[model samples]
Target: MFEISDTQKIGVGLAGFGIFFLFLGMLLLFDKSLLALGNILFISGLACVIGLERTFRFFFQRHKVKASISFFGGIIIVLTGWPLVGMLFEMYGFVLLFSGFFPVAINFLRRVPVLGTFLNLPGISGVLDKLSGDSDRTRV
Candidate 1:
């Protein structure tokens, strides 16, 4: 049986093509005239190769060290005249910071008086679950 889910098929196909494009892009990078195409292919391939879930988890998961590294790395890159790479690093840094901070903020708020009650409210809790993207739907 060669049965495959649509999601799996898409993911696999994208990954395959992504690898090819990524290599092609890297190879083409040596030619200044074709650098633009290389950049497009590289970015597209990278996006396809990683897929959204992994990318989201990379940014959203708890990773203080990685985030700090990215933030500072971006700064260093910018200083070295690589604005584009620096921008990417900075973007990752901001996302990592947000992801890392939100949970801490939520925990701190939970200890507050009125805010804690509001956070525990049924409607508010639902929103929190949605924001946190927890599939289990269980409460603490």
Candidate 2:
């Protein structure tokens, strides 16, 4: 029943992680002591950010208040947390890695069992179907 073009990709939030990894890689390239450790954090953070962005976009596109708040929240959080979060990735590797997976994990959950389909319903399908059906109804 699922169609290819009709299927949506889970949008990734790579920006946050990209920023985190970019900073971390810069930190690591500058300070080689953490080459191994930094690599892990970089990969994980990248996943988190890309995944986060996609998820946010998906839900954000749907609701009004939620979208507005999330849009503002992302800007505020990124602006405020940019330095702090970047540093966190640098100073605390594990925290950054965990941060990345947690969201992907949540999104992954929506792909499984009953709960997944229920929450991820495209929401617009039903409306479009109704409107397109028998446009002849409008014939005067």
Number of the top-ranking candidate, with lDDT as the measure: 1
Among these predicted structures, which one has the highest TM-score?
1
lDDT of 2 by residue, 38-127 (tens): 444433444454555664564355434443454334333333535334444434433332444555564566557887666445563333
* Segments in model 2 whose C-alpha atoms lie over 4 Å from true places: 1-59, 64-68, 80-140
Backbone clashes for every candidate come to 0, 11
lDDT of 1 at 50: 63
Off by over 4 Å in 1: 1-3, 30-55, 64-140
Model 1 global lDDT (CA atoms, 0 to 1): 0.59
Candidate 2, residue 67: Cα displacement in angstroms equals: 5.9
